[model samples]
Target: MEATVASLVEHGWAGTTTTAVAQRAGVSRGAQLHHYPTRAELVIAAVQYIGAARIAEIREQATDLPTGPARTAAVLDMLARVCTGPLFHAALELWTAARTDPDVRAAVVPLEAVIGRESHRLTVELLGADESRPGVREAVQQTLDLIRGLGLADLLTDDGARRRALLADWARHLDARLGS
Candidate 1:
Protein backbone atom coordinates (compact mmCIF):
# COMPACT_ATOMS: atom_id res chain seq x y z
CA MET A 1 0.00 0.00 0.00
CA GLU A 2 2.79 2.38 0.87
CA ALA A 3 4.49 1.59 -2.41
CA THR A 4 1.22 2.04 -4.28
CA VAL A 5 0.52 5.44 -2.78
CA ALA A 6 4.04 6.70 -3.29
CA SER A 7 3.84 5.67 -6.92
CA LEU A 8 0.46 7.32 -7.27
CA VAL A 9 1.82 10.52 -5.77
CA GLU A 10 4.91 10.52 -7.93
CA HIS A 11 3.02 9.45 -11.01
CA GLY A 12 -0.73 9.96 -11.02
CA TRP A 13 -3.08 6.98 -10.95
CA ALA A 14 -3.08 6.78 -14.72
CA GLY A 15 0.65 6.32 -14.58
CA THR A 16 0.94 4.19 -11.44
CA THR A 17 0.64 0.50 -12.23
CA THR A 18 0.52 -2.46 -9.88
CA THR A 19 3.74 -3.72 -11.41
CA ALA A 20 5.43 -0.46 -10.50
CA VAL A 21 4.20 -0.71 -6.93
CA ALA A 22 5.43 -4.28 -6.76
CA GLN A 23 8.81 -3.27 -8.07
CA ARG A 24 9.06 -0.34 -5.66
CA ALA A 25 7.97 -2.47 -2.72
CA GLY A 26 10.33 -5.25 -3.75
CA VAL A 27 7.39 -7.64 -3.75
CA SER A 28 6.58 -10.08 -6.50
CA ARG A 29 3.94 -9.07 -9.03
CA GLY A 30 2.07 -12.19 -8.12
CA ALA A 31 2.00 -11.15 -4.51
CA GLN A 32 0.71 -7.72 -5.44
CA LEU A 33 -1.95 -9.29 -7.61
CA HIS A 34 -2.85 -11.71 -4.85
CA HIS A 35 -3.60 -8.78 -2.61
CA TYR A 36 -5.36 -6.64 -5.22
CA PRO A 37 -6.95 -8.12 -8.29
CA THR A 38 -7.99 -4.85 -9.86
CA ARG A 39 -6.71 -1.30 -10.16
CA ALA A 40 -9.68 0.07 -8.22
CA GLU A 41 -9.10 -2.28 -5.32
CA LEU A 42 -5.48 -1.29 -5.14
CA VAL A 43 -6.26 2.42 -5.39
CA ILE A 44 -8.81 2.20 -2.63
CA ALA A 45 -6.51 0.24 -0.36
CA ALA A 46 -3.64 2.63 -1.00
CA VAL A 47 -5.79 5.64 -0.13
CA GLN A 48 -7.12 4.05 3.03
CA TYR A 49 -3.65 3.13 4.17
CA ILE A 50 -2.40 6.67 3.57
CA GLY A 51 -5.36 8.27 5.34
CA ALA A 52 -5.04 6.02 8.35
CA ALA A 53 -1.38 6.83 8.77
CA ARG A 54 -1.96 10.58 8.42
CA ILE A 55 -4.79 10.52 10.94
CA ALA A 56 -2.72 8.55 13.40
CA GLU A 57 0.03 11.10 13.09
CA ILE A 58 -2.39 13.94 13.76
CA ARG A 59 -3.88 12.26 16.80
CA GLU A 60 -0.47 11.57 18.23
CA GLN A 61 0.65 15.15 17.74
CA ALA A 62 -2.49 16.49 19.38
CA THR A 63 -1.96 14.25 22.39
CA ASP A 64 0.87 16.43 23.62
CA LEU A 65 -0.84 19.75 23.01
CA PRO A 66 -3.60 20.21 25.56
CA THR A 67 -3.60 23.97 25.36
CA GLY A 68 -5.84 25.52 22.73
CA PRO A 69 -3.27 27.78 21.07
CA ALA A 70 -0.55 25.18 21.00
CA ARG A 71 -2.94 22.64 19.59
CA THR A 72 -4.16 25.08 16.98
CA ALA A 73 -0.64 25.89 15.90
CA ALA A 74 0.22 22.24 15.78
CA VAL A 75 -2.82 21.36 13.72
CA LEU A 76 -2.07 24.13 11.23
CA ASP A 77 1.50 23.02 11.03
CA MET A 78 0.37 19.50 10.37
CA LEU A 79 -2.00 20.71 7.67
CA ALA A 80 0.83 22.57 5.99
CA ARG A 81 3.01 19.53 6.12
CA VAL A 82 0.27 17.30 4.75
CA CYS A 83 -0.49 19.64 1.90
CA THR A 84 3.17 19.55 0.98
CA GLY A 85 3.49 15.82 1.52
CA PRO A 86 3.38 13.12 -1.13
CA LEU A 87 0.29 11.51 0.41
CA PHE A 88 -1.81 14.55 -0.22
CA HIS A 89 -0.44 14.93 -3.71
CA ALA A 90 -1.35 11.31 -4.34
CA ALA A 91 -4.82 11.85 -2.96
CA LEU A 92 -5.25 14.86 -5.19
CA GLU A 93 -4.24 12.80 -8.17
CA LEU A 94 -6.71 10.12 -7.16
CA TRP A 95 -9.40 12.75 -6.83
CA THR A 96 -8.83 13.76 -10.40
CA ALA A 97 -8.98 10.15 -11.48
CA ALA A 98 -12.11 9.63 -9.39
CA ARG A 99 -14.11 11.50 -11.98
CA THR A 100 -14.02 8.65 -14.47
CA ASP A 101 -13.15 5.84 -12.09
CA PRO A 102 -16.17 4.82 -10.07
CA ASP A 103 -14.19 2.58 -7.80
CA VAL A 104 -11.70 5.30 -7.00
CA ARG A 105 -14.50 7.72 -6.13
CA ALA A 106 -16.20 5.14 -3.93
CA ALA A 107 -12.96 4.59 -2.06
CA VAL A 108 -12.59 8.31 -1.49
CA VAL A 109 -15.88 8.63 0.39
CA PRO A 110 -14.78 6.90 3.58
CA LEU A 111 -11.48 8.71 3.63
CA GLU A 112 -13.20 12.06 3.14
CA ALA A 113 -15.64 11.38 5.95
CA VAL A 114 -12.80 10.64 8.30
CA ILE A 115 -11.00 13.80 7.27
CA GLY A 116 -14.11 15.91 7.82
CA ARG A 117 -14.71 14.60 11.28
CA GLU A 118 -11.08 15.09 12.24
CA SER A 119 -10.99 18.60 10.77
CA HIS A 120 -14.03 19.57 12.81
CA ARG A 121 -12.61 18.05 15.94
CA LEU A 122 -9.26 19.77 15.47
CA THR A 123 -10.92 23.09 14.77
CA VAL A 124 -13.17 22.96 17.83
CA GLU A 125 -10.39 21.79 20.10
CA LEU A 126 -7.85 24.40 19.06
CA LEU A 127 -10.46 27.13 19.18
CA GLY A 128 -11.22 26.16 22.77
CA ALA A 129 -14.87 25.67 21.95
CA ASP A 130 -17.28 23.22 20.38
CA GLU A 131 -18.90 23.41 16.96
CA SER A 132 -22.14 24.27 18.77
CA ARG A 133 -20.70 27.67 19.48
CA PRO A 134 -21.46 30.22 16.75
CA GLY A 135 -18.02 31.71 16.14
CA VAL A 136 -16.30 28.50 16.99
CA ARG A 137 -18.08 26.73 14.17
CA GLU A 138 -17.37 29.60 11.82
CA ALA A 139 -13.71 29.70 12.76
CA VAL A 140 -13.45 26.02 12.08
CA GLN A 141 -15.22 26.49 8.78
CA GLN A 142 -12.96 29.39 7.89
CA THR A 143 -9.83 27.45 8.63
CA LEU A 144 -10.89 24.74 6.20
CA ASP A 145 -12.25 27.22 3.72
CA LEU A 146 -8.85 28.81 3.56
CA ILE A 147 -7.19 25.45 3.21
CA ARG A 148 -9.30 24.45 0.23
CA GLY A 149 -8.09 27.39 -1.84
CA LEU A 150 -4.61 27.34 -0.45
CA GLY A 151 -4.10 23.66 -1.09
CA LEU A 152 -4.86 24.07 -4.76
CA ALA A 153 -2.78 27.21 -4.93
CA ASP A 154 0.10 25.55 -3.22
CA LEU A 155 0.09 22.93 -5.92
CA LEU A 156 -0.51 25.12 -8.97
CA THR A 157 1.42 28.21 -8.02
CA ASP A 158 5.10 28.60 -7.29
CA ASP A 159 4.74 31.75 -5.23
CA GLY A 160 6.51 30.70 -2.06
CA ALA A 161 6.16 34.11 -0.42
CA ARG A 162 2.38 34.05 -0.77
CA ARG A 163 2.15 30.57 0.64
CA ARG A 164 4.34 31.55 3.57
CA ALA A 165 2.21 34.61 4.20
CA LEU A 166 -0.95 32.56 4.19
CA LEU A 167 0.49 30.06 6.62
CA ALA A 168 1.74 32.86 8.86
CA ASP A 169 -1.66 34.51 8.84
CA TRP A 170 -3.32 31.21 9.60
CA ALA A 171 -1.06 30.65 12.59
CA ARG A 172 -1.65 34.20 13.79
CA HIS A 173 -5.40 33.85 13.56
CA LEU A 174 -5.40 30.68 15.60
CA ASP A 175 -2.91 32.09 18.03
CA ALA A 176 -5.14 35.09 18.71
CA ARG A 177 -8.34 33.07 18.83
CA LEU A 178 -6.96 30.50 21.23
CA GLY A 179 -4.90 32.99 23.24
CA SER A 180 -2.74 30.36 24.88
Candidate 2:
Protein backbone atom coordinates (compact mmCIF):
# COMPACT_ATOMS: atom_id res chain seq x y z
CA MET A 1 0.00 0.00 0.00
CA GLU A 2 2.88 2.36 0.83
CA ALA A 3 4.43 1.55 -2.50
CA THR A 4 1.11 2.06 -4.26
CA VAL A 5 0.61 5.47 -2.66
CA ALA A 6 4.15 6.49 -3.49
CA SER A 7 3.66 5.39 -7.07
CA LEU A 8 0.47 7.40 -7.36
CA VAL A 9 2.13 10.50 -5.93
CA GLU A 10 5.18 10.15 -8.15
CA HIS A 11 3.59 8.84 -11.33
CA GLY A 12 0.04 10.20 -11.29
CA TRP A 13 -2.98 7.98 -11.91
CA ALA A 14 -2.35 7.25 -15.57
CA GLY A 15 1.20 6.12 -15.01
CA THR A 16 0.60 4.17 -11.81
CA THR A 17 -0.03 0.71 -13.24
CA THR A 18 -0.47 -2.49 -11.28
CA THR A 19 2.89 -3.72 -12.55
CA ALA A 20 4.58 -0.59 -11.29
CA VAL A 21 3.02 -1.02 -7.89
CA ALA A 22 3.97 -4.67 -7.82
CA GLN A 23 7.54 -3.84 -8.71
CA ARG A 24 7.71 -1.12 -6.12
CA ALA A 25 6.21 -3.38 -3.52
CA GLY A 26 8.62 -6.20 -4.47
CA VAL A 27 5.77 -8.58 -5.04
CA SER A 28 5.11 -10.88 -7.99
CA ARG A 29 2.69 -9.62 -10.64
CA GLY A 30 0.55 -12.67 -10.07
CA ALA A 31 0.40 -11.95 -6.37
CA GLN A 32 -0.62 -8.38 -7.04
CA LEU A 33 -3.20 -9.51 -9.53
CA HIS A 34 -4.54 -11.96 -7.00
CA HIS A 35 -5.19 -9.18 -4.57
CA TYR A 36 -6.41 -6.63 -7.11
CA PRO A 37 -7.75 -7.91 -10.39
CA THR A 38 -8.02 -4.50 -12.03
CA ARG A 39 -6.24 -1.17 -12.03
CA ALA A 40 -9.27 0.59 -10.58
CA GLU A 41 -9.49 -1.91 -7.75
CA LEU A 42 -5.81 -1.55 -6.97
CA VAL A 43 -5.97 2.22 -7.01
CA ILE A 44 -9.08 2.30 -4.86
CA ALA A 45 -7.57 -0.04 -2.31
CA ALA A 46 -4.40 2.03 -2.26
CA VAL A 47 -6.36 5.21 -1.61
CA GLN A 48 -8.35 3.63 1.18
CA TYR A 49 -5.25 2.09 2.74
CA ILE A 50 -3.28 5.34 2.67
CA GLY A 51 -6.25 7.38 3.82
CA ALA A 52 -6.69 5.18 6.85
CA ALA A 53 -3.04 5.60 7.80
CA ARG A 54 -3.18 9.37 7.39
CA ILE A 55 -6.28 9.61 9.55
CA ALA A 56 -4.59 7.56 12.26
CA GLU A 57 -1.61 9.90 12.17
CA ILE A 58 -3.94 12.89 12.52
CA ARG A 59 -5.67 11.34 15.51
CA GLU A 60 -2.33 10.63 17.16
CA GLN A 61 -1.11 14.18 16.58
CA ALA A 62 -4.36 15.67 17.83
CA THR A 63 -3.87 13.98 21.19
CA ASP A 64 -0.64 15.89 21.86
CA LEU A 65 -1.92 19.38 21.02
CA PRO A 66 -2.26 21.82 23.91
CA THR A 67 -5.53 23.69 24.47
CA GLY A 68 -5.89 27.50 24.09
CA PRO A 69 -4.80 29.87 21.34
CA ALA A 70 -1.85 27.65 20.60
CA ARG A 71 -4.22 24.82 19.81
CA THR A 72 -5.67 26.85 16.98
CA ALA A 73 -2.23 27.40 15.53
CA ALA A 74 -1.34 23.77 16.05
CA VAL A 75 -4.50 22.48 14.41
CA LEU A 76 -3.98 24.75 11.42
CA ASP A 77 -0.40 23.58 11.23
CA MET A 78 -1.52 19.99 11.21
CA LEU A 79 -4.16 20.65 8.57
CA ALA A 80 -1.61 22.44 6.43
CA ARG A 81 0.77 19.53 6.75
CA VAL A 82 -1.95 17.10 5.78
CA CYS A 83 -3.15 19.08 2.79
CA THR A 84 0.37 19.57 1.40
CA GLY A 85 1.63 16.07 2.09
CA PRO A 86 2.02 13.01 -0.12
CA LEU A 87 -1.23 11.35 0.88
CA PHE A 88 -3.19 14.35 -0.25
CA HIS A 89 -1.15 14.54 -3.43
CA ALA A 90 -1.84 10.90 -4.19
CA ALA A 91 -5.53 11.45 -3.53
CA LEU A 92 -5.39 14.45 -5.85
CA GLU A 93 -4.05 12.20 -8.57
CA LEU A 94 -7.00 9.88 -8.12
CA TRP A 95 -9.44 12.78 -8.08
CA THR A 96 -8.00 14.22 -11.27
CA ALA A 97 -8.25 10.87 -13.00
CA ALA A 98 -11.75 10.40 -11.70
CA ARG A 99 -12.87 13.55 -13.47
CA THR A 100 -12.88 11.72 -16.80
CA ASP A 101 -12.71 8.06 -15.91
CA PRO A 102 -15.99 6.49 -14.85
CA ASP A 103 -14.31 3.43 -13.32
CA VAL A 104 -11.96 5.55 -11.27
CA ARG A 105 -14.75 7.87 -10.27
CA ALA A 106 -16.93 5.01 -9.18
CA ALA A 107 -14.18 3.67 -6.93
CA VAL A 108 -12.98 7.01 -5.63
CA VAL A 109 -16.08 9.09 -4.90
CA PRO A 110 -17.41 7.14 -1.95
CA LEU A 111 -13.96 6.71 -0.41
CA GLU A 112 -13.21 10.37 -0.92
CA ALA A 113 -16.49 11.31 0.73
CA VAL A 114 -15.60 9.19 3.76
CA ILE A 115 -12.16 10.76 3.99
CA GLY A 116 -13.61 14.27 3.66
CA ARG A 117 -16.12 13.65 6.42
CA GLU A 118 -13.49 12.22 8.73
CA SER A 119 -11.15 15.13 8.04
CA HIS A 120 -13.86 17.63 8.96
CA ARG A 121 -14.74 15.68 12.08
CA LEU A 122 -11.10 15.58 13.12
CA THR A 123 -10.65 19.31 12.62
CA VAL A 124 -13.76 20.14 14.62
CA GLU A 125 -12.79 17.74 17.39
CA LEU A 126 -9.21 19.02 17.60
CA LEU A 127 -10.40 22.61 17.82
CA GLY A 128 -13.10 21.66 20.35
CA ALA A 129 -15.40 23.80 18.24
CA ASP A 130 -19.13 23.37 18.69
CA GLU A 131 -20.67 22.73 15.30
CA SER A 132 -24.01 23.75 16.79
CA ARG A 133 -22.70 27.28 17.25
CA PRO A 134 -23.79 29.59 14.48
CA GLY A 135 -21.18 29.86 11.69
CA VAL A 136 -18.77 27.52 13.46
CA ARG A 137 -19.10 24.75 10.88
CA GLU A 138 -18.80 27.22 8.04
CA ALA A 139 -15.65 28.65 9.57
CA VAL A 140 -14.12 25.20 9.83
CA GLN A 141 -15.08 24.38 6.26
CA GLN A 142 -13.54 27.63 5.09
CA THR A 143 -10.33 26.82 6.87
CA LEU A 144 -10.22 23.43 5.14
CA ASP A 145 -11.04 24.90 1.73
CA LEU A 146 -8.33 27.53 2.13
CA ILE A 147 -5.73 24.99 3.13
CA ARG A 148 -6.68 22.73 0.22
CA GLY A 149 -6.39 25.59 -2.23
CA LEU A 150 -3.02 26.54 -0.85
CA GLY A 151 -1.94 22.96 -1.11
CA LEU A 152 -2.88 22.90 -4.78
CA ALA A 153 -0.81 26.03 -5.27
CA ASP A 154 2.11 24.38 -3.52
CA LEU A 155 1.88 21.51 -6.00
CA LEU A 156 2.41 23.97 -8.85
CA THR A 157 5.41 25.88 -7.43
CA ASP A 158 7.39 26.90 -4.36
CA ASP A 159 4.68 28.65 -2.36
CA GLY A 160 5.72 27.81 1.16
CA ALA A 161 6.11 31.40 2.32
CA ARG A 162 2.70 32.39 1.00
CA ARG A 163 1.04 29.32 2.43
CA ARG A 164 2.53 29.92 5.87
CA ALA A 165 1.54 33.57 5.92
CA LEU A 166 -2.00 32.78 4.79
CA LEU A 167 -2.35 30.01 7.36
CA ALA A 168 -1.11 32.23 10.15
CA ASP A 169 -3.55 34.97 9.24
CA TRP A 170 -6.42 32.53 8.94
CA ALA A 171 -5.52 30.96 12.25
CA ARG A 172 -5.94 34.29 14.01
CA HIS A 173 -9.32 34.90 12.41
CA LEU A 174 -10.45 31.37 13.14
CA ASP A 175 -9.34 31.61 16.76
CA ALA A 176 -11.40 34.75 17.24
CA ARG A 177 -14.45 33.38 15.49
CA LEU A 178 -14.41 30.06 17.29
CA GLY A 179 -13.11 31.44 20.59
CA SER A 180 -10.71 28.56 20.88
Winner by TM-score: 2
Q: What digit string (tens of lDDT, one per residue) describes model 2 on residues 65-99?
A: 88766778889888788778888898888789889
Instruction: For model 2, give the 10-residue run with minimal summed lDDT.
Output: 60-69
Which residue runs of candidate 2 sit more than 4 Å off their true CA positions? Answer: none
- TM-score versus the correct structure, for each prediction: 0.82, 0.94
lDDT of 1 by residue, 1-180 (tens): 778777887777777988788899999988888988887788778878877876666566566555534556566666666666676687788778877878888998778888878867865665565555445567767777776666777786664577667767787875555443
Task: Note the Cα lDDT for every prediction shown.
Answer: 0.72, 0.85
In model 1, the runs with Cα more than 4 Å from the true position are: 63-74, 156-158, 171-180
Best by lDDT: 2
